[model samples]
Structure formats: structure tokens, C-alpha cells
Target: MTQTTLTSVQFVKSLYEAFAQGDVPTVVGAMDEDIEWYEAEGNPWHPGHAFVGSQQVVENVFARLAQEFEDFRIDCRRFLADGDTVVVEARYSATRHRATGKPLDVQAAHVWDLRNGKLVRFQQYVDTRRLADVMGVSNY
Candidate 1:
């Protein structure tokens, strides 16, 4: 991992792939060992509340998302990189229902912090309105 820059477009690609696949080992392989991954609290769509660190990322974010959602998908549409920062625009599609496989499309964006060729911090932007509805929130 030291041979590659973590904040690069490729890093984001790998990160999303690992996350989309829910491959905890692969995702952890790319982490900085002291990485911090954040998600908003009380997000209706997510399996649960906000989380911090790589450990939480796998257990709370990745594993829970996969376990809760029947089929999860992430499509990275756009990406831009500068120095040790990367911005990615993506279309995230998934099915929260465990039985019928219906898609919920939500536009997403993320700002990543890279240091020493490893992902240090990450902040994500998402279409919360649509996502909230998908999570069965009628009055969002």
C-alpha cells in the first residue's frame, strides 16, 4: 500500500469495490491501520447510525449493509483527484427489501483524505431524500 497513493482515483475505485462487495479483508488491506470512516447518524437508509474508524466501517457500514440489504450496488460515475484528496460522484443503487429486488437509486458524492498512501479520512454526500423514502420513511 505504501507504493501507491491512497488519495488517488484508483484508491477510491478500490475502496468502493471492496465496500460494494463487502470484502472486509480487502477493504482493511487498503486502510491506514488508523483510518477513520464516518457516516451520518440516524440515516434511515443505512443499517444503523453513524460510525467511526475502519473497524466500524467493516462491521457497521459494510457488513451490516450487505446483511440488511438484499442486493447492494454502487456505480462510480465521476472522479477527480488533486494532491492527496479525491472527490467522487457516484450513483448508488440497492434494494432494502430482502424479498422483492427493487432498486433504489441515490446519487452520491464523497471526499476522501489520503495520507502516506493510505486512506485516512472519508466524508460522503448522498441523496438523502430519495434514500430516506426508500428506507420506508414517508415523511422525510
Candidate 2:
């Protein structure tokens, strides 16, 4: 006989649930203390090549988002999983922008790595063009 583990789809479903509930504490708590992340110009609040450590991530990324957007919502459309790796395609839309009185709507995918039952790394991919327009960046 053989034992089967939870599918990647199931893992991501639970993860997305954590996000959709506005449960930052749960999400952050699930991350490894020394997690790494990468984001692009589309996400100016957390734009960078790569970041290390959970504290740096909390301060540089999540906190930045909280400062800029309110009533945030994250939804995952599809997911692909293999072992502990989970890749999710999601659309994020927020009713309020922290910097301006406007809405922030974005579509993106997030790749995550789960190790020892905690998310150790995450990378969000989005269109730089759309992000720029939302941020109102004057030029490249």
C-alpha cells in the first residue's frame, strides 16, 4: 500500500483562503523567518530584485502594501502543485488606494514554496505597464 499526500491544488486553496481573509498574521506566521521574495515595478510598494529575511519582507513589502491600499482582496484563479511547490494564478483588487482616493486592480500570479508546513519563499509576477499606470509614475 502507498500513502498519498494532499494535492498541490489543495495546499494553495488553503493558502489563498488565508490571504482572502485578510489574515496577514497567519500568512506571515506561516513564512520562514528567512524567506526570500522578488517583485517588479508593477508593485512599487514592494518593488525590488530580491529581498531576504522575514522582517525585511514584513517591513519592505507587506507593510508597504498596507500603507498604500485598504480593503485589500486576493483571489486565486488557478494553481499548479508538485510536491511542496505551489504556483497560483490570481487577480488582486482593492477598493481603496492608500496613496490616492482610487481603486487598485491588478492581475498576477504568485509562486510559493512550502517547506516543513510553512511558506519559505514567494514571488509575485505582474505586468509592469499596468502597474506603472496605477502608480501614476511619470516615466520609466
Candidate 3:
């Protein structure tokens, strides 16, 4: 049996779909071995450093998200691809913040860089103040 590899845009879309279904293994499987994942600067998960490799991302980002938010979802609005880079404009919605009980609805952009069809790097851009407010964290 021959497996067909997905294009960059299709690969990114598949990742989102997997994430929506709570399929963390599938999402992590698409990442490059040395993948670098960055949360927005003011995001509570941003520890002044990048989460290198799939294990770190799963441990630090995905796990924390599951622990901190209720009914969290990513609504991808648009996907733009340029060679090895793909940009997704999306909105994040959560029923409530686990710590603060605040509802969350925020727009965000995700920039993904792929190398030979493997996701190599991810940079997230989001409304830090709103996220902070929902998480009951001081943005300043």
C-alpha cells in the first residue's frame, strides 16, 4: 500500500481537524522532529521561550490548554499558503476559563512553516489582553 502525502495547506487543515477531534497524536505526528512552537508573547503559556520538539509542545501547550479551558475550539476562517509557509486566520472560542470562569472569544493568526511536508515551526498571534482577562492574569 502506498500512502499519499498531503500538501502544505491540506496538511495544516488536517492538523486543525485532528485537533478539533481531540486527536493529539495525529497532530503531533505531523510535526518535524525539531519543531519550534511559540505561543503569543503575552499568552499565559508563553514561558519566554519556544517549545522545542513535539513532546514539549504536547506537554506545555496542549496539556495546559486542556487543563485550563472548557469546550475550547479553534474556528479556522481562512488559509493562505505560500510555498512552505501557511497562514491561518482563526478565532478561538471557549465556554469558560477554568481558573476564572470567564468566556473566551478571540481572533488569532497562526503562521506555520513546513519543510518537506513536515511542520517545522509555528508562531501564534493573538489578542493578549483578552486572553489575559479571560484567564484572570495581569497582561502588564
Which pairs clash inside model 1? none
Clashes of each: 0, 1, 0
lDDT of 1 at 119: 77
Instruction: Write one digit per residue (lDDT tens) for candidate 2, span 11-114.
Output: 55765677677776766776778777877544655554678877878788778777777777777788888778888887777787766667777788888887
Q: Put down candidate 3 lDDT per residue, 1-140, tens digits, no spaces.
A: 00127777888888898899999888888888999999999888899989999999989989888999999999999999998899999999999999899999999999999886688899999999999999998866
lDDT against true structure, model 1: 0.70
Q: Write the per-residue lDDT of candidate 1 for residues 1-140, one digit (tens) a residue.
A: 34173438877787677776766677677777777665643355354543556787777767766775667788988899887889888887776545334467888888888887777887767877766666666546
Among these predictions, the greatest TM-score belongs to 3
RMSD of each: 3.1, 3.8, 1.9
TM-score of each: 0.79, 0.81, 0.95
lDDT for model 3 comes to: 0.90
What lDDT, from 0 to 1, does candidate 2 have? 0.71
Name the lDDT value of residue 76 in candidate 3: 99
